[model samples]
Target: MWDERVPVHVAGDFYDLDAFRTRPDVLRDFETAEVGDVTGRTLLHLQCHIGTDTLSWAHRGAARVVGLDFSAPAVEAARALAAGLGHGPERAAFVTGDVYDAAQSVPEASYDIVYTGLGALCWLPDIRRWAETAASLVAPGGFLYLAEFHPVTESLDDATGTRIVRDYFARDAQVWDEPGTYADPDAETVHNRSVQWQHTLGDVVSALAATGLHIEFLHEHDVSVFPRFENFEVRGGYHRFPDGHPRIPLIYSLKATKG
Candidate 1:
């Protein structure tokens, strides 16, 4: 499903390829601010679809960067995009592989930063395994940074776009087959079958801690990088709930150190 939606996203208004070509800082403002100073650091991006944010790190002067994704098409496109950025494999590279298998596929404890998640964690089947792999990937003295859509915000109503309809602490994965793509909602109908798990803030924090990664900070913000829900107004450069509506956090960022 992701592979099929790649072209739709690359050519859609959501990604804005033209704007990205000129302004290379494709990551959100908070993400850039939180994961500061990537210069001279070896960074690894997991589930990096199309490598926009991965190459954005390169733009910030990362010494070397590797972006791994399960989609072969996305990885292929990322390689092309990196080439266009005037950086070869030595400085930047994209690999096709499942994020859960990254520990075995890539060199462990070799990256100064292990960056992952941005509407990516829900697709993962197990947060514990994900945390363990992330901990293993981060080199000693390095850290793992995650900026993800807040599960709290998502547990609210989606189908009706009103009221909290789903369980906040549901341990099971929900199956979805929505035809419209988030990037291009009007695109041709495509098979979009997938399973997503519901993970609370505690699940995320506990997983990281169990892997021995000391949590440096966990911050939640009302701003969101994506239009994950309905009834949002763009304010302060983020899609947020309306002015009168009860303001709630839409995104959460975590910084955990590999001690």
Candidate 2:
């Protein structure tokens, strides 16, 4: 499913590949402030789709950046984009492999920063395994950083995003065979089947803590990178509920470090 959507995402206005070529830094303001300076550091991005966010770190002065994704086409596009940005494989590399095997799949054994971007955790069924695997690649003194859509939003009504309509503690995978992609909903596509799991805030934090990664902080924000709810309006490049509406966490970021 992800393989087929790579082209759509690359060409669609959602990503705006052309504009990205000119001004490639797309890291959110809060993410940069939380992650701190990445200059001369090696960063590994897990589940990197099309490598925009991964490359954004590279653009911000990370000495080395590697992006790994399960989709072959996504990796290929990432490599091409890296080359276009004047970065060779040594400076910006991309690999095609499952994130669960990141320790073995990545070129280096570990990295100074292990990053997992938004809308990624929901795709994995075992949050514990993901934490252990991802943490294993965080070099000593390095940290694993995660920016995700808050799980609480999943339980709310899709339209109003106000009332809870689904079980928050549901453990079963949500299976769907929906048509079209998120970038271009009306786009012609075939591989639309997908499965997603829900992991609460505690589930993610506890899983990382179990791996002996000290929790630095967990920050929740009222804004989202995508228009998750019908009532969301654009604010500072993010989607937010109306000013008068009660605010709920739409996104959360975490930083966990090894001793």
Candidate 3:
């Protein structure tokens, strides 16, 4: 899924690689501030599509950063990008593997931070397994920080207009068979196989808690990286309705620490 979208995303203006490089800390002011300083920490980024956020951590003075993704092409691209930036393979590295198998691939209790960036968790089918892998990878007292799209945003019909067509708590898999890419709707594609699962706020919190990771904080933000639903207005950094809009969470960030 990510392999097909990587090139498209890199070429698309949505990622804005130039802007990211010019302003390395694009996510500095966001919810990640709760994670505090990462300098001298060993961080592991899961489902890192092209490793922009992973590279950002390296730029933030992390001692070592490893970006893991299922897409081999994306891993290669991320390594290439890191090398081009003069970081080489020492500061950062990219690996290709499934999130569930990450525990077997990465040493247990080796990382100080297990991080997953925006728009990452929805791709996983099992949140329990995901949480377990994250908890297993984190060293004692280490943290797991996830900044993801709010489950409420997934309930609306983003394809056509701002309409609540799906249940917010629905655990069923929502199949998307669209041909055009999210970045470029007009671009032709060779493969369009994509599957996503919608998880609620409770689902995320409970999953992490079940893994024996204590929750530190969970915050909901009105703003998101993209305007998910049609007819939503972009105000400041948030996408919201004009007024009298339904009260719903648009984005959420969670921080948990291992005991």
Candidate 4:
């Protein structure tokens, strides 16, 4: 499914590769501030689609950045984009592999910062295994940082997000058969079936804690990266509910350090 969507996403206006080429900072202001400076750090980005966020870290002066994804086409796109941005293989590398096998798949054994970007966790079935695998790649004294859409939204109505229509603690996998990608909703395409699982904020934190990672912070925000709810308005590069509308945690970020 992800393999077929790579081309569409790369050419779509949602990503805007042309704009990114000129100004390659796609990261949110709060995310950069939360992750702090990466002047000389070695970072690894898991589930890195097209390497935009991965290369963004390199743009921020990270000594080395590597991106790993399950889709081969996405990896190729990322490598091409990195080269186009004047980043060499040594400075920014991309690998094609699964997130569960990331430790063995990546060129480096470990990194100073192990990052999992937004919309990544939902694709994984086992949060515990993900934490264990991701935590293993974090060098001692290093940390694993994840920014994801809040699971609470899954329980709310898709349109208005005002009422709950699903179980909040449901452990079953939710399958989606919708056509078109999030980048281009009107686009015509196949391979639309997707299986996803919801992991609550508690599930994510506890899973990392089970791997002996110290939870540094778990911060929730009212804004989202995409227009999750119909009532959401674009504000300062983020989506939020309009005035008089109730606010909910649309996204969250967590940083866990290995002892």
Candidate 5:
């Protein structure tokens, strides 16, 4: 799955590797501020593609950081980027493995924080299993933090002007055969077949609750790290609905802790 998307992400300007390297603290302003302090803490990032965000956490004072991805090429590229950025193998490490099978390689309850970023959950088929694995990786009293694109935005059809084309509560597999990638809309690719699953807001909360993780906070916002649907306006670093647009959730963040 990720193997096909790695090149598209790296070469595209959306990730803005140059901007990230020059000013690494960009994302820290809005998304990671709620993560609190990670000084001397062990952090694990699931579906961490290319280690950009993982390295950012390490740069923010994490004692140790590990990034896991399903794509071998992504892992290799991430390691290479880390070495290039002077992170080396000591401060941060990258592993290639499925998010569902992450426990087979990493030990249980070994991390102080389990962090996942935007667009991570839709790639997954089972939210319950993903939450269970995430909960299992955190030590007692540790927390799990996630910032993801809201499912409400997923149901809208942006191509036709914010029409609610899909059901908001649908839990089904949606396949796309587009020729361009999100990162680079102009880049043409042959391996365009992609599979994704949509889970509702209730489904997400229930899945985490089932893992014995206590919900600390669940925040809904109109901002997104990236442009989600077409025709969406980007202002003040957030994506917003058009004038007099109906109320719809765009993004959400959840914080949970192991009891």
Candidate 6:
């Protein structure tokens, strides 16, 4: 599913590589502040779609950055992008593999920061395994940083406008057969049928804690990097609900350190 969406994203406004070529620091503002002082950090980005965020980290002063993805096309594109940006393979490298499987593929306990998710966790079925992989990748004193769509926010029915419809604590992967990619809703579609899971806020926190990662802070916000529902307003270079809409936590961020 992700493989087919690569070209669409590459050409779309969401992952604008043309703009990226001119501007190396295209990371979202909050992300820049949260993943602070990457000056000499070895950062690893898992489920990294096409390495924009990975390269963004590299540009922010990460000494070494690796982007891991399940899609071969995305990895190839990411490598090309990093090379084009002149970071090349020395500073920025991309690997094609499932995030869960990359624990063995990438040198374990090597990275200073393990990063994942803007819209990543939903695609995975096991938070337990995800936490373990993140924990294993970061060295002692290093941390796992994540910013994701809130499960509560995701559970609402956007198809018929915002309303509670889906299970917030669903234990199984939900099947989606919708056409079109998120980047281009009108484009010709491929691999429309995909599976996604829902993880509650509690589940996410517990999974990392169980892996022995100490929670630094868990912050929630009403804005997101993309419009997740109908009629959401774009503000501060992100998306949020208008003043009168039902207020809910649309995004959540957490930084957990490995002891």
Clashing pairs in 4: none
Tens digits of per-residue lDDT for model 1, 1-259: 9899888888888878778778777778888889899989999999999889998999998999999999999998888888887889999888888888897666444699999858899998899999988888999999999999888876688532457877888998799888868887778866779899988999999999999999999999988766666677788788877777777778899999987
Candidate 3 stretches with Cα past 4 Å from truth are: 107-109, 157-163, 243-247
Write one digit per residue (lDDT tens) for candidate 6, span 143-215.
9999998888766888424678877767876898987888888878768999988889999999999999899
User: Comparing candidate 2 with candidate 5, which one achieves the higher TM-score?
Assistant: 2
Pitting candidate 1 against candidate 3, the one with the higher TM-score is 1
Q: Candidate 4: misplaced stretches above 4 Å?
A: none
Q: For residues 106-158, write the lDDT of model 2, one tens digit per residue.
A: 99999999999999999999999999999999999999999999999999998
| Top-scoring candidate (lDDT) | 2
Compared with the true structure, all predictions reach lDDT values of 0.86, 0.95, 0.81, 0.93, 0.82, 0.85
RMSD list, candidates in order? 1.7, 0.7, 2.3, 0.9, 2.0, 1.7
Task: Give candidate 2 regions above 4 Å deviation.
Answer: none
Worst 10 residues of 2 by lDDT: 234-243
| Arranged by lDDT, best first | 2, 4, 1, 6, 5, 3
TM-score, predicted candidate 5 vs. hidden true structure: 0.92
**Best model number under TM-score:** 2
What tens-digit string does per-residue lDDT give for candidate 4 at 41-152? 9999999999999999999999999999999999999999999999999999999998999988999999999999999999999999999999999999999999999999
Better of 2 and 5 by lDDT: 2
Task: lDDT for model 1, please.
Answer: 0.86
* Better-scoring candidate (TM-score), 1 or 4: 4
Output the better candidate (2/3) by lDDT: 2
Residue-pair clashes, model 5: 0
lDDT of 3 by residue, 59-125 (tens): 8889889998989999988888788777776678888889899976653346999999888888888
TM-score, structure 1 vs. true: 0.95
TM-score of each: 0.95, 0.99, 0.91, 0.98, 0.92, 0.94
If both were scored by lDDT, which would come out higher, candidate 1 or candidate 6?
1
Count of steric clashes across candidates, in order: 0, 0, 1, 0, 0, 0
**Which whole-number lDDT from 0 to 100 does residue 169 have in model 1?**
84
